[model samples]
Target: MTRQVRRLAERTPPQRERYADLLRAVAITAVVIGHWLAIYVTRDGRGFQGGSILQVASWTRPLTWLFQVMPLFFLVGGFANAASLTSHLRRGGNAMGWVLGRTARLLRPTTMLLGGLAAAALTARGLGAEPALIGVAVWLASIPLWFLVAYVAVMVLTPPMYALHRRAGLAVPIILTVLVGGGDLARLVLNVPYAGQANFLLAWLAVHQLGFAWQDGRLPSRRSVALPMAAAGFAALVLLTVVGPYPVSMVGFGGERVRNTSPPTLALLALAVTQTGIALWMRGPGNRWLRRLGPWTVVVAINSMIMTLFLWHMTAVVIGVMLLYGTAVMPDAMPGSALWLLLRVPWLACLALVLALLVTLFGGFERRAGRWAASVGTVKGVWPTALTIAGVGAVLAGLLALALAGPGHHGPTGLPVRVLVAYFGGVAALGFVRRRYSRPARIAGR
Candidate 1:
């Protein structure tokens, strides 16, 4: 690990923003820990049933305020994507090429996650595991995966959006945000079914645009500027949650009639803005601290495994619980009891150990994806465009299927049969795009 960190530190561009890496690490870590803390799995006489500390402990709803970190992700995503695209265009890169690169980077590790889960689900069934248990296991393991769909959707739109950014400056995000507010009105007030789904992109686009602002220096680092931004964001959030109908959670609570996160309500956007202000305020200090070797080394190492770690953290929890209970040594404590609370510390530690093992084994997919960035095809004109659209559409559709259906959900495992077919078909469609339509070297250079 030290050697890996040393190599990363050596290869890192001097002007590269270390703060982004730090933020990524911090965001993922907070999410992992928050999941461990908030999820309260209970074992009734009928094996394991999933529950949440938030359900039993209402005080923890406020904790979601601090722990909800998805906003930070889009904020950072917008920043990174803009900077990357701007640099790529200067080097004469094409839009399809950029899209292929980004999708591959995300999907490489994703293939491992989905593929492995399918295999595991199959094996459990072969070993005579019950379908209900399999369903719950697959569902909980996949909790982290839904984020990929939203992120990739936003990523696919980056080229045109960046163009819009170049022309309209900050107006693009403002317009998107206003649309989010409108969506909120439509969904909550008019009771429109699925109207809020639009904000899944619109709300995130708003935060992502701020990333553009941060990159171009339009978002000033002045405390006066940041403080007021924070204050206003905080104020709006209070109004929405306290005075209005929005839930206070930055994340969705199980069984809640209204969830701030599942569809992304206006209050969550308010939280994102507030977090953006705080992130900007702290950027300087964070960067300065990252200038040193030791701290930066940890950041580099963590960033290298970022995708693997995020994807597998929940799986680690499932693994830990199984090993502990399956062994029949550790007595199950009633959830929310003094002993149950006391056991959480050790439980988290065990979960971390398993997570480390998973990362060590699967983190290579991310590295391989980085090396395997490829252009879609040699075919020119709308042919390439058509293929790119089809490819992305197929992948999104497969992911949605997987998100909706658990892996190996087919009475027997063999592959999360439907999901495997969907996701693999999507990947093949993408691969077909690259092979069948790749730009020839001669014209690509031109």
Candidate 2:
């Protein structure tokens, strides 16, 4: 593994933005570790239950500013998608084809995760696990999908958004940001129902548009730009949370009256801007640091299976909770208590071990999926493009349904009929398209 990483590092192009890769690696790592730390598990008479540390330690809410790194993911995603799409277009690829290729990488691994969780949920049911417990368990496991719902949508929109970026430059994000602000205002001040939902796309699209700027060199890594941008963003963030009715916690927990994240308020966008500025500020030194073989090797390795690690980290937590808390191997130290704090080291270590094993087991799927995606040729005509769009829409719709309605919502099979059909049908459609268009693999004789 080390040798492979070293080789990858050695072969990396000098023009590549290593800092962007580093930021992606850092963002996903932060999310995994942050989630593990935030989840507070305790065994109850009914079964094991989990809650967020933020609920118990209100002081910890403020720390979410540092830990809520989803903005960074979308930001980096925008950068990556813009780059990938441009390369594809330059190679004379169609927009739909590029969308299909990019989304295939994401959807492939996601399909595996949902399938695995469903099978596990069914097995637990056969063993007489309570339905409610199963539902909660599946819900917790699928929490990562909530972010994917937004990401996949934004990803699918990238081709069009990038086109807009080319024409409008910074004005695109500015308009999106204004719309996000209006959404927040409607939801908060007017108490309008579901109006803030627009920010789900607008806010993320806004952050993503910034990535386009960075990619095109419209947003530079200069002290003058970075300093004021960061300062103004930070100021807005403080003001919104402290005085403007938004919660201090950037991450949403159960039962929060107002969250910066769920619908994504202006406060969250402020964090995105703040993070964007900070990322730009670090680009100079960070890229230079990544030039070192050792650092670059580590970043390469992490980025290779970053999605797998993110998707399955919560499952590792669930497994650890079941094995330890279920069997009374883990002590019931109340969250925020001294003993709980002291036990965090071992707790984290145990979760890490479980996560490592899960990653080792499932990471191959991601690698193979990427290989498959790479092998497929671009779609040429209207029919194939339509097929690709329909397939992607079905997949996203199914994923959103599962995320909203737990996989265990229907009990024994662990998935609703429509959800299973929609998801698998989409995967099958994509598979068919790939097989039809795939370039033949090199053979021994060839």
The best candidate by lDDT is 2
lDDT of 2 by residue, 171-217 (tens): 99999999998998998899998888888889999999999899988
Inter-residue clash pairs, candidate 1: 122-413, 376-434, 377-437, 377-438, 377-439, 378-437, 378-438, 378-439, 379-437, 408-416
Each model's lDDT comes to 0.80, 0.84
Model 2 misplaced stretches (Cα beyond 4 Å): 326-329, 406-408, 437-446
Q: Cα miss at 445, model 2 (Å)?
A: 26
Number of backbone-clashing residue pairs for each candidate, in the order shown = 10, 0
| Residue-level lDDT tens digits of model 1 in 1-446 | 67967888877888898898888888999999999988776565878766788887777788998889988988889888988877666556677777877787888898899878878988888888888778778778887888887888998899898888888988987888889889888888899887888887788888888888888788876788888888899999999998989876777766788888767878998898899888888888989998888889888888887999999998998898788753444467666778777878878888999999999999988877876654332335687677778878878877777676644345465334566676777777776666666553335657
Query: What is the alpha-carbon RMSD of candidate 1 to the true structure?
Result: 2.4
